[model samples]
Target: MQFCDECGSMMKADGDRMVCTNEACAASSERDSDLEDQFVTTESQSDDDVIESTEDANFEGKPKSTDVVCDECGTQEAWYTLKQTASADEPPTRFFKCTECGHRWREYN
Candidate 1:
């Protein structure tokens, strides 16, 4: 990632150029091709992969009772956990799995 020359903040890609994310600075520059090659991209997980990973992380081994209503099977019982998905100041996201149909969903507080 390139740093903004004006504000010294990390610049983000905007089409063929890099733009400063800081609203106060709002500076933009051409994106270097060599730097683009060094940019890291996160590998997306498939549905099966995500499900397998979640199942493997079932520390309690049993579904916990929750008041969340499942969208798939309209079940009222679910297993829930808090996952940190954003910055430290932001609230942890809630992930839920329906006990009846195994449907998964996320709720942001």
Candidate 2:
């Protein structure tokens, strides 16, 4: 008897394929093809492709998303405060505050 890789349950061979009795286990097997498709990377054929990838990785021409809008004046301006700092045991984090209305919010990684 073959075993189900997902659930470790016994699988019955049916002609050319084996089947899992558990519904969740069966669903997981079906997802492998989808996962494989996502991870398939196409190779770049020219130098222009390398330059474009480098620019993207360096965040060139990218607009900053750190600014918070002022609710009262509809202005695209705000203030920020750092709530956490990097240490031997922890990582750095930041939070923002609206300068006009004192609205506070936390930034996520």
Candidate 3:
């Protein structure tokens, strides 16, 4: 969080010292060991942190099942969604994901 005194630019940690980010000024200073210790990096996430899984995480979104065959695995079932990708006058795009192989494809309407 330290700034260069010469050119008023942010200083970054360079080994055991702090160096100015500005190439023109190129100011360097000794970093305080105590301050460095206080600013030491720590893990942000813990084992106790619980993360909820999204429906898309496992391709579990409500499937608009169709007879479309998968090009990768020849699977007949898939999850489909319509997305508005074009202008107002144009139709929405159809996106499909194969349930068995997770292969995705898009069709413009």
Measured by lDDT, the strongest candidate is 1
Worst 10 residues of 2 by lDDT: 50-59
TM-scores for every predicted model? 0.44, 0.27, 0.44
lDDT of candidates 1 onward, in order: 0.73, 0.46, 0.73
Writing each residue's lDDT as its tens digit, candidate 3 over 2-100 gives 789999998888877889999999999999887865563324336333221234544456455776888999998887766677898999776787888
Question: Residue 80's C-alpha lDDT in candidate 2?
Answer: 43
Which parts of model 2 have CA positions greater than 4 angstroms off?
A: 1-66, 70-74, 85-91
lDDT of candidate 3? 0.73
Ranking by lDDT: 1, 3, 2
Cα RMSD for candidate 3?
A: 9.9
TM-score of 1: 0.44
Q: 1 or 2, which is superior by TM-score?
A: 1
Clashing pairs in 1: none
